[model samples]
Target: MDVTVIWAAIIALGVLLYVVLDGFDLGIGIVFPLFPDEDERDLMMNTVAPVWDGNETWLVLGGAGLFAVFPVVYSTVLSALYLPLVFMLACLIFRGVSFEIRAKANRTKHLWDLAFIGGSTGAAFFQGIALGAFLQGIPMDGGRFAGDAFGWLTPFSLLSGFGLVATYALLGCCWLVAKTEGDLQRRLRKLVWPLTVMLLGFIALVSLWTPLQDPAIAERWFRSGLFWRLAPVPMLVLACAAWMRWAVHARHHRTPFIAAIGLVLLGYAGLLVSLWPYAIPQGLTLWEAAAPRESQMFTLAGAAFILPIILAYTMLGYWVFRGKVRHGDTHHYH
Candidate 1:
């Protein structure tokens, strides 16, 4: 197989992992305002505190893979998204600091809580904006970003931001339903239907908007035989949504979370199918953006060894922290 395709797959896997793993934690922050009770907030934070940082490992891996395997693409995207990217980093830093300091100072806990909410909102919004901008295609001249600093701002990008916020919030709500017990779980159960309905609406909006944004995408999706073959992607996602709604209503603890995760995975797969071969939407192919074969091979060698270790550690962490977080469990990370 070509090294470019190999690295692309690796990068895709890393990205998928990051979105699913870190997504629910970010969602927790998004839904923070819903649970005004300090005890409930603590329990919610406790559910994610141990695994949150570990969940970001895939993000680091994905970024590094992009840099190593597609240096030109990395540079172009960063240049194109300089401001949003910087803001995202700041948001992530603020969010991480809140986790540490919120536990230290009683009086300043409220401030930290605000930071967590703001940071998560900023991070998720900008990420979705970036995704929308990328899908619409970045302006490029000779493989370099040619657009102004505010080129990424558009109506579609803004809508994408809100959509992602809803997606993450849904994931967070489902996660709470799974990990928590008693009144907290019951409250989360009440939220599931609304969040799921909102998510389905966003999915519908994106589904309508995607093909319309680009003729190539429209042709690939609606004008080809592939459309019929790939129709099951959205169908499966809808099924997951239905299953999650039922599971939450039925009070099947783990099933709702699993179904929510499956929904995200299916949505991501659909996006990838719509954007294959192109590294930067309509701008460049994977072969064009990829580093030289020698460079790719060298990085591939290191990634081959390192990725498994990361995967094993991730699995071990989940296993060690397995099972429901009982009410008043002091074993949770503070």
Candidate 2:
């Protein structure tokens, strides 16, 4: 068995879990301004409070796993994208602080609210920028990053940033639909169709624009035999969008969220399809960038042991918190 491939799969799973789990909460912050009432905002915040921090565990796992198993890629990519990564972390810190302190603040509550919104939006935007930069391929020399500090800021990256913001907003809206009721839920449901439309627009733009930016990617999708095999991905995305719209129109709360997740997974799958075999896009293959086989084997054993424990606790947290968050329900934050 290829232990490198195993480790790569593990890390991919971790990243996907992080994006899906944390994306919605960050999205809640993205759409916070739409619902101006303090009580409504509180209810929105409460829906995610118990599990928001926990969702970030996957990010730590993904990052640490990359550093351990693919140190070369980790070092090179981090160095290339240092500025944006730091900005993303700063946003996350402010978002977390605002998450915890927003409930307690009286006079400055609005400030925290703004922080939450700004932090979430900034973090999501930067993440997409980093992704676009990575996808467009990092410049490398002798297995080291050979890119400018501001290379990540580009038209494609900017488009990707806005795309992710819309994606998260849609995810957050679907989540609220399942987790709240009455006027807030109704308003949230109303937002769902438009958010879905907006997300689809961004997805289409990214899908077309990425190929234009990188001819190799275009060749891989078009001239290569890979096109027929990967055809279902876009079809599935359309199906998920249709299902989400129908669910919202039918007033079926949970189905829309499930469909939203389906859309995310399909989009993620398309990305993986676009950049398979290469750990650092056009720069380095996974095998070339991987740590020593012995090191990967050792780390895999530990990850194998720990992954289940993390999965167990995550499942437990969600199960325990399952149910609609009502307006007057007493929360731990209070």
Candidate 3:
């Protein structure tokens, strides 16, 4: 078997899982300001409190897997995007600390709330910026990053940053809709249509903007037979949006969240399609950036054993915590 391809698939899956899993929690922070009622905020935090930290495992997996199997990509990409990545990490740390402390805090709860909002918003925005910068292509010299410190700061990257914030907020809103009840759930459901519209706008902007910014990507999408084959992606996105709207209108609790996930997956697939085979967009291919065969084999063996264990535990956690969160529930994170 081509362990390189296998490893690539593994890393791709890990990153996608990370985005879908942790995206909502970070999103909760983004949407935190909308529902200012202290009890509503408490309930919002409660929906994710059980699974938020656990959801980040995929991130660790993706980052470590890249560092291990594609050190060249890791080093060069990290170097090129160092500032945004550092800011993203700092935001994640602040968000995590605030997530824990906010529950216990009384007067200082408001402060923690602000921290949580800033942290989550900062993290999501920077992540999108990193993604946009990477998509636009990293300057490379002798297999090293050849970009300046501010290379990642661009109009395209800034748009992507805000787009991601919208995406997460929508995701968080859908999650709250599924996991809360009564007035909170009603408010969340009300927010879902507008958030979905905002998210779709961002998706459309990114989709159109990316190809215009990168001729290669433009050609990839429109200049060949690949276009016809890839046509279903956007169609599917619209279908998912329709499904989410219907679910919200019908008051079906779980469907909107599921449909929201579908939208994220489709967007992710489009991105992967755009950047296919390139570890660093317009730079290195996966095979070209791969570590030695023996190292891949060793890591694959370890991943084979560990991934199943992680999957099992993650499934168990969700199953155990399954059900709508209501106010005054004694079983919450607080």
Candidate 4:
């Protein structure tokens, strides 16, 4: 691969890494309040405490890869998705504060708890919106961004925003079941059903909207022969989800959670394949917007070294925190 292609691969990998790493954490935050019971909340928090911060490294890696390698794509995508980006950044900030403050506050931990929810929701929803907009393709002019500031706020974007939120929440609940037991686990099982239902509904709505928004996308996926090969991804994901639903209710729990993660991975891979070779959906081909070869080589060298180390530490953190979360008696955390 040339500089542009290699760098594109790096950044794309970074984004996928972020989706896999922080994805669960964000999902948990969105689903946290599902169980209003304080004990359940503690159990849920414990499940993520050891690794949430580390999970955010993927976001950093993705951002840095963009800045270092594909500066053009970064600038254009950010400029077009400025509103959603700002919303996402603000959510990350609030969520971080809430994470620490909730553990220290004496009387008003409830406020921090609420902040976590808001931040997580804001971050997850805006991310989905941005994803939808990107997939819809930005309007580019002379190799730069030329999109309306509010172009991202279409109905399709909003629908995608909710779809991601629901998707993350379901994943979060499944994580909770895997990490906790007793009343909390039972509560999570109950929660996953509605979230699952909502996920299916959102996907169906998006499916209907996709072809309407862009006939090309419709042809690529449904009308053209590509659908024969591409269609299996969604079908596999659906089968996995059905199996997860069955497993979650089968008095066996971990298998369902594992299956849910598999479903997420497969579905995401399908989207990536559907839009491969295009850095910005149908706009700006990857090589057309690539950075200098020397710059890419330098950045790749550093990432190749650092990425694995980060992955190792992330794995270690999870391993250390493995098992049931014990949040102590009814005392206020902060």
Model 2 spans with C-alpha error above 4 angstroms: none
CA error at residue 177 for candidate 2, angstroms = 0.6
Give lDDT per model, in order. 0.87, 0.92, 0.91, 0.79
- The candidate scoring highest on lDDT is 2
lDDT of 2 at 21: 93
Which ranges in model 4 have alpha carbons more than 4 Å from their true place? 222-224, 328-334
Residue range 1-334, candidate 2, lDDT tens digits: 9999999999999989988999999999999999999999999999999899999999999999999999998999899899989999999999999988999899999999999999999999999999988998999998888889999999999899899999888888899999999988999999999999999999999999988999888999999899999888888889888898889889997999899999889889999888889998888889999999999999999998999999999999899989999977837535
Candidate 1 local Cα displacement, residue 149, angstroms: 0.5
Put down candidate 3 lDDT per residue, 98-155, tens digits, no spaces. 9889888898999999999999999999999999999999999989988899999999
Q: Score candidate 2 by lDDT.
A: 0.92
Candidate 4 residue pairs that clash: 105-334, 106-334
- Residue range with the least summed lDDT across 10 consecutive positions in model 2: 325-334
| TM-scores for all predictions | 0.97, 0.98, 0.98, 0.93
For lDDT, candidate 1 versus 3, the one ahead is 3
TM-score for candidate 3: 0.98
Clashes of each: 0, 0, 0, 2
lDDT of 4 by residue, 1-334 (tens): 5767666676777777677667777888888776687656666776777788888888888888887776888899889999999999999999989888787786988998899899998999999999989878899888888878998988889999998888788888888788777877787888877777787788778777877787667767787787888767778868877887788679576776677677667757766766777777777677777787887788888988997899799888878767666566224323
Model 1, 1-334: lDDT tens digits are 6989999999999988888888899999999998888778888888888899999899899889999889888999999888878888899899999988887769888999999999888888888888888888888998789999999898888888888888888888888888998988998988988988898898899989988888989999999898998888878987888898789778898888888888788888888988998999889999999988999999999998999999999999888887788656734676
